[model samples]
Target chain A: MAPLEPWEKVLISADFTQSIHGRAGCVACHRGQQSPDKDTAHVGLIPDPSQDAQRVCGVCHGEIVDGFGTSLHASLQGYRTIVYSRSVPENHPALDTAMQNHCLSCHTTCGDCHISQPKPVGGGLLNGHNVEKTPSMTRVCTACHGSRVGAEYLGKHEGIPGDVHFREGRMNCMACHAGTDLHAAEGDAAKHRYWGDQQPACKDCHAQVGRADDPIPQHTIHGNKLACQVCHAVEYTSCDGCHVAISEKTGNPFFKTEATYLSFVIGHNPWPSRERPYEYVVLRHAPVAPTTFEYYGENLLPNFGLLPTWTYATPHNIQRQTPQNRSCNTCHGNAALFLTADKVKSEELEANRRVIVENIPAAIPIP
Target chain B: MRRVGMLLLILGVGVFLGACASQGISTPTPVPTAPLPEAVLTPLSQTDYCVQCHTDKEALIETAKPEEKAPSESEGVG
Candidate 1:
């Protein structure tokens, strides 16, 4: 910042010559350099920071620009959201914003919704202005999510004895992760299947034998013997502590799978594990066929955040207004309870009844 | 009596069609929340801070042995 030496001034002017607008000094953008008293908010995810920076990128990286713009989500900023809509007067109901959350989340960039940056904190929301892309965004993702998901959802399991992707396919996570919408709903809301949907009972998936109308209870038979993590998980290396679990550059998990399968399984769902009525089933495997019990152990692992609070506000979980646990019967009502399977008739599981999960739990069979 | 019923019917339809719900919009009603969610700022613990990227090694998976699947021997899986 001090006056450059004569040779240094030559270099600084040479650096300035590289710019399209050579008249304005670098101080135009780096105003903080002008005076220690001023520091600009280094925020990213802003609207059209000097059109040249935001809109003119197509001149350089045409394809990346087009892809990001066509992605639809690229246009999310400077938009009205649900909160603004709700504030509308009752007399003027057709406000600009739609109440649906699907479109609204994009309006608030990923960093805004989660209240942090994507990778290594995306330079913090207020400080992300002049950043280029980095491998860290995915790390930011796993920062919020955890490694077990990579293993459980994508089939990248470390505990599978030999790592499958490592052995032959050399699969990298980007192979499966170049997507954003992870909702099982597949954009169809009729099933209301969201990654975050709360289901009173997973009986829909875990019970050995349940019709759509039956309560998904903990499997009372041998089905419970297997740990849920054994089947329902895939990649956890990135989640082990870093992101980009299996780097495409180097097709290996950042944290190699260390435990044997039996060890991993036992560590998670201990055989003869406590059979108490579990209200929370955070991670479980997808139910196996024929019997189709949506038992609690379907894809369980990770050893943390299994408490009621973590599962709260999840779409499948009935959302309580507050984070505090509502009474067990708030949604269950007297006729049916939250743990449909636990509350199921002993005869129901023995017989393997049919179940239907609506806002309420009721057995089928028009009896 | 029939004429009176007809008069009431016409009045009812007028109110239904001409009147709007507070706002001119006619929409389905929203359900009630048992209790409203209050917002509180929670501080992140260091381990939780670390969990932002890495899978928390301490995640708990719940599995149980059904009476049916109980092994004859209780030996742990090696």
Candidate 2:
């Protein structure tokens, strides 16, 4: 995305001036002087007042602001869960510093969604200071999630079509992910996005699935045995061996991935629960290795094998009919489509032992 | 010739009056009202200097500087 012009960043519109938020006056949110002089007016200016959402937005939106502290978007607890599992308490300080430099920038505030683009994308006002109830899918939501989720949903990969929901239904992220889910309540203790009940499950809308008298024979036989993505999802991105370091020359943090390619691999469910109760689910290779945070200190992730490198995945690229579901033989007896012992790296084989399919299902017998 | 000149002058006056009527230009009418106490006039009710300047397109363009690149890094696994 091209960066916005200087004027475009600060320009205010007439519609905003008459809005309920705008009527509160600039100083009500942004604590700045009302003087005509530019320097005098900018004294003690708060560029993003919503950074302190408790005091600023809480006046009107107290309910949301109260629970926002625990939200994944604000707390970034999911990252900590994985990072802590891989490191000892002694190495926390160094790991924290690395995260602060490289990962903390992804943290979002209220203004990041409603008023401006995300900080990662060089935030500018989405619509001349007007507050958007539903953030722009292209500008705000996809700005950070663009690398994999955005690409898969929008079909950026060559020869791959976009998700059927996006291509056919024109449903944006908000269509499935509700605002309440994004602003997860204070007591909600789910560590990872996939840990709890599916926020937007397939069965929520498609109630007809798994019915006894269903028309499709596969629906009855395979519904409980496989995750919907195992058959519905097509090839999606899987990254490997991502390393992060601070540049000595420029003193800026950056990350490099060893490889990123499209693949479709079904493996045993690593985190099977009531919500995701299936023997088989799609897997994607995450961009993490033993030395992922080595820049901070030596062997920061000593227990890296505590978690699998090829984690369970729910790819965004869904299709009504995929190559895997064309017929029983398309996936059955097809060892190439399954993550087996030979498919994994030598070092990671131990970590991913739980997910690797030991016995690929045999081909169906002929009549 | 004198009669023709008289008719032209009358037509000009009629056209001028019609244009003014079309534009809804009428004499101002005064309505009486009591002045409110000074305490009722709050700062929130008025458009402050900040809004006055920011809404002005010309003023913003004149003051805005070239955008500086925001420091960024590659995508991390989430």
Off by over 4 Å in 2: A185-189, B1-47, B70-78
Candidate 2: pairs in clash: none
Stretches of model 1 off by over 4 angstroms after superposition: A1-138, A147-163, A166-170, A179-340, A343-367, B1-78
True contacts kept of each: 0.00, 0.65
Per-prediction TM-score: 0.26, 0.88
**Cα deviation in Å at residue B35, candidate 1?**
85
lDDT of 2 by residue, A12-118 (tens): 89899888999888988998898888779999999999999988998999999898887889888888888888889999999999888877888889999999999
- Quick one: best DockQ, which candidate? 2
* DockQ, all candidates in order: 0.00, 0.30
Positional deviation of residue A199's Cα in model 1 after best superposition, in angstroms: 24
Candidate 1 residue-wise lDDT, B13-69, digit = tens: 888876655557557699776986899855332222111111211221111112222
The residue-by-residue lDDT of candidate 1 on A149-213, one tens digit each, is 33333333443322333234454443433433221122221122221222222333335433344
